[model samples]
Target: MSIKTQKIFEAEFLLEDMREIIRKTSPHSAFSKDDKIQFNEKLKKLSEIVEELRTNKYTELKIKYITNGIELRTREEDFINIHPIQAAGRLTLEARKALISYGDGYSTCDWCRKPFRLDKIHRPPIDEFHSELAEFVGMDQARVVPGARRGFQAVVSSLIEKGDSVLLSAISHYTEFLAVEDSGGTVKEIPLNEKNIVTADATVQKIEDVKKNTKKLPKLIMLDHFDYMFGNEHDVYGIAKVANEYDIPFLYNGAYTVGIMPVDGKKIGADFVVGSGHKSMASVAPSGVLATTDEWASKVFRTTQMVGDITGRKFGIKEVEMLGCTLMGGTLISMMASFPKVVERTKHWDDEVKKSNQFLDEFLAVEGSKVISEYPRKHTLTKVNTTESFDKIAKTHKRRGFFLSDELRKRGIVGEFAGSTRTWKLNTYGRTWDQIKYLGHAFIDIAEKYDVPVKANKQGQYSGDV
Candidate 1:
């Protein structure tokens, strides 16, 4: 197809939509007794304005903006700022600062993390580095907005236009698939290798085969830095290099590995990257980050709304001196503040978790279960896939992760189920080896209760996505 499509994907979270649904179906939170007077007053004012906006008969009201000795009148009574760019430039700085300071640059779990406050009265050090961090995960560098609605949609739409040939994993994140489909990209899944890893070679070979057989070079290369379902690590940097060699732009998503994995965009040499703030960064919910090369950053800036107002803007020295105020920004500030600590603590914990995984791997091997990816190079969120004959395998630890997750919560352990899918990704950080050991044993007990086969030695059979 010679059709050049706009490949943008936008993901939006439906909080306001949910709120409206709740309002119509369950209006309990609509207005309390305290808000009754204010609500009525607002409603009365709205009615009066609506009445004033409507004139008798078909008469029209004109609103005119006078500029350069010319009166531009609008019969439809719509108003727009003549200097939107100027207003945007002025507002962007303050908004950015507020966004940065709201979370006080840190994130702790609801149970174990701490909340930091940046007061409007005191200024923080200006030179602190808050980098956009990620690993070789797959995602395009679109803008990240507050929720799944406006921001994600914009990103998805930009990349996946109708009839474009795209490749993805069958067991990938469903939201990503939806985004691609919405953008009209035709998805083709590359089957898992025998070892189940999405090796760079495997992906490249698939592209070559597709080209040779179907006479088409893939327009876009898509894959995650870390496979979400199988706990497999694709060599993202390797793939990017290959794609670069082949003249294809790589869209990398660093969802599972962003915060936890140490990835450098420049070192990796990828074209576009997107990540989640809540995943690894201690950012608050509804925050995310997208990074690209300076050249692409300009292109994305053109397609995106370049709002200067973020939680990271600063005021004039006179304003700062008079108000004596600073801080007061977005949750990203907390993520920024807490990121180094979180990364440090998580790294230390990750080493321990790897040690634990080895122990479990050996124990399961004795029980006739297979452990995939022996001596895994990085940390992972586990996924267990067995033959169709082993349908009962899911039930073995189906509730174990949840039970352990709740138990950890009790013990102030704060790992999240990365997304709402069946994949229960555990955070190795924020807990001790003793906890993981206990949880491992608990999983064994659950497996036994389900009558799953286990060997007496349980040596090497620990196959899972981590």
Candidate 2:
């Protein structure tokens, strides 16, 4: 039975931390022997598409309705509740009245401009459907999390108290310092700058060096509208104008900048924010999203239903808040019906993430290397080198980014690599521009045959040059 549940989820399993870092970085024995015979013919075409979806040979081919979000859900349904949080707040008010009647009707009914079926849309009006997702992120309310880290531990247990004082950013996002030390609160951190950018004048000089050597004014702050280990992008309205000149609170994390930047989290004076809906709205995976103000959403919904009524819902809280409310009801009805064509397919992967950061900053400014910041964020930045060449550019861009995430999972294409940097994540959602110029010419021919500085003829300094 599935090899006895893969040997009981691979024995002594702590979810095989990235398969034990791909088995102690033997990383499938660093490819080459003709890239290990094209990665064993791409693992036998992903085991012939998982043995043709286990012999049904594609039971009417529903690769989650041809991938890229909203295939309604199904791993054998049943989170029965005429209650998946009240049928996901009545399917987020029937997908906000089919996104305001598919943006004010005017349809010559080709199935009313196709795409509606989450069982034919309807229930909208839960007080104006999560107030149009809390006024589309300038929040005055929002708290939906099928997981934005329990909407960041429901705004750190409704704005800290049991020994408060939380600031952030000494290389942050370690799950917002484990949700402010599992909510008894304390954190502190601050430091960053030699291009690992975290400024608003270094978070107002660490809130003026913690109010001139600490007695606590840091009631809570947090950061990350980019800067997941070097794809830096911050300013967050100049650190919410220095947390409104020290009235404190802040909290941004916009989980990789909510759908890749242009967050308003109330014109950036964030009292709270956090997003992900599976990293910018395709949802699935423990979704995530949070927001604030309606007096911090009735004080984080009474500290998130008093930690969901004394955590009866499980061991260590978050029992799939109904699979994060059915992947936040198919990630907010596939992000309000294809968020303006997912921002017009993110301008064809913003010229392949500015030509893979000017082909890794002209291949590390011709081995003189440096460029962490002179401006780098069209979507995730940071190009390494500070002697150890950060462990040989994180073991040669993690074996060419896990052999381009196993050749984009043999053409079904999915990407991820930003954790052990030589950093690789340039998702140009539902790609093109020759699959981002053949995954940026196979990551600049494996960072120029492992000499790894990376560049060859300035991929003409990005501007419509894919």
Candidate 3:
């Protein structure tokens, strides 16, 4: 059972990715064949060890297809990765340890009983975890979806009818648009304010305008607590109020807020809450949660009344929106494993923001660099303008925009877009203070090396003025 395994979970995942990379190349090429053979050899060795463990394992083993960041690892152990989306999603040691036990197919369903639904599974305490997750975000009920996008799909498909209108932020994620489209609904954008932030006033005007033109209220109102583009907090509480006033249900998109920071769905007057486990919670890819208030839980999570035409059977307990159970694979298990740590991390969010602000404070010391995100950093994700700073160097450098990525990689900092210089985003979530400090110094050091002017630095202070 509990075999003392090495940290091979990540190493083996990387090996699988390596195989995939070679598969996409010229298969007939000798080089490709050679690389594939080498990968297969190592994989076989890993498989042998896994087989030994599995024969004796009643509990833990070192075998699982962990599809987290397989395509691009950036070696978090060796490099400081500020990749905007992945900074928080990196799995905890416990989550990896969990993979040893539940990484097999449908591992979480071994004790499925009664209604035979995922949320009803009580052996691993999954049913209770669902309840805890609901309360974690201040909602009455919760279900894990494949991703935050799927969470949007569940809400839209549950409510939206053909030709119905939905309200969304002008800078809404593309997946939101797709979710509405799948439900045969048209979405009208609520334009951002001068500060590039979505406001309740704008949402109100958009709803009224849609109502006047279409002669009916929109089916749903969806807004991000923090938009992905600018990582700027929107007027979500205000929008919730507007939605209530307009007699419309509001879905709070918490892809950026939920796991990293405390999200009170009831307090925000949210009819539904959607969060990304792979984006904020320290979990595997394609995992998230959709929570709803008691008022909307019945409708959104409505069970199927479909009967088997040939078998003459009914599946009344199965949720139509979820198609019974949403996440039943390793993705769900990983989310379960990371839940406790994720809950505790939310409390330290203020400290994370402080680290973010501190890093930005020094980053701005590079004369031309600017922070495009909201000042003083409410959250760890941010958009920075390096056009006037790094872009200047990129224009004259031989490697062009790649010069930045290349240099940062040399300094053990990674996750920036190669050949990108103008405007880009990064996250400082879950990084240690020392790592954050080194990140700041790395940028400042690079700037000074490039002959960029430096401003006088007052360290450890929030310098929002760039």
Candidate 4:
């Protein structure tokens, strides 16, 4: 489509997408009769433009981008985006609708009330959503934060003081270390086990070593439920038990687990459970949930008591850690709009894991290819080594490392880390079974083309071959 056609196309597509939604929306929802009239009028105008573009032949038209050029990102629409962090975060149709309505900074604050808190606004039932979020993760309280990193900052700032020590997995996200540093604390890493996964026993030993050297119990223990690099599930339950045994506060980093799967903070004996809304909750970027038990919520969400020196003014109800309120815009609204579907999808996590293994079983059939992460994968994000297979071709191909990317792109696949054929990561989180098989076949077909011999699946898990 020409720029002229595409602009009108997108506009019409959006209003039509929201037409059914506005009809089905609750009576108290924000849409009004005037809003409906505006929608219809806009759609009619766009339809006329579309008819004009069609009559004139859209491709022959030259449309100018009057300002900074911006256009639709057709990656998800045009190709299989297997990027690790993105698969689970792709927005729902409902979220897209919400974004159309609440894209501005002040749009979400229209209903701000007496408490003047992000979680207290009820016009769109934001207050109810906050309560639901707490129960979703088996926590007593929850708050929306910018991202999982901010959630970590809140917990670290609350419990960790200057010179305090915290223990975390060796493979934990860098934000964890940054959070600890922000609070003037030191971080101690718990070593990975033989299989490259964090274990409860290792956590205990790390705590013991921290105590031996620092001469005190660590102030906090935080670990990832599933690490980003390997996407392998760590022993969070056992690690949380270890924290309990030592009477230390535990923070479960669910950047990879929450939203995609069911998680119980209390069941894991965790004091805090943090999740990335954009990374896993199908929301916009810079959105996340920070949840905690009542026992720890008071301190973590403590209000500011500092009085303004000049006028003796104080904001007693404003939470100090969250900087009073967070995510007061489309970011929060989109997350709420996607909440219902996110909840339903968590129940199908087993099927998701099954699909991951199904794809990997066939993918590994290409001789010399290797699964770098844990075998029979437990998560969609995977680290793979094709050094012995595709890298061999990269050595002599004209495009070198880019040849593999070129071939994958030809097959309608994208989002593999570009220019790296030796070892790289990909995600299959939300891909359909047919798409997964297509991916597997794409790999095998590419292998055959490059003389990278494809063999039968020894496990018979995926019998189809390219």
Best by lDDT: 4
Using lDDT, rank the candidates from best to worst. Answer: 4, 3, 2, 1
- The lDDT for every candidate, in the order shown, is 0.47, 0.53, 0.86, 0.89
Which model is ahead, 1 or 4, in terms of lDDT?
A: 4
Better of 1 and 3 by lDDT: 3
Model 4: lDDT to the true structure: 0.89
- Cα-based lDDT at residue 155, candidate 3: 95
Question: How well is each residue in 1-466 modelled by candidate 1, as lDDT tens digits?
Answer: 0001100000011222333444554547565564555545555644543444453222233323334766542211221111111111112233334453343333222222112222211134222232223222332233333322222334556555677666665556676677668878766766666766666787778788778866887666666776655556777777778788888767667665555656566667667666665554545455555656655655443322223476644432212111221222454355455555545643463574475475455335324344344235354354432222123443454553354344333433233342222323333332245545554554455456556565544454433322
- Report the C-alpha displacement of residue 214, candidate 4, in angstroms: 0.9
What's the TM-score of every candidate structure? 0.53, 0.30, 0.84, 0.89
RMSD of 4: 5.2
| Model 1 TM-score, all chains together | 0.53
For residues 44-118, what per-residue lDDT tens digits would candidate 2 score against the true structure?
Answer: 555554565466443232233313665533211211111111111212233334543433322212232123321
* Model 2: residues with Cα > 4 Å off, grouped in runs: 1-101, 105-191, 197-208, 211-214, 225-230, 233-252, 255-273, 276-279, 282-297, 300-370, 373-433, 438-466
lDDT of 3 by residue, 44-106 (tens): 766665665567543344443334644433267657889899988999878887875677778
* Clash pairs detected, candidate 3: none
Model 1 lDDT-worst window of ten: 2-11
Select the stronger candidate by lDDT from 1 and 2: 2
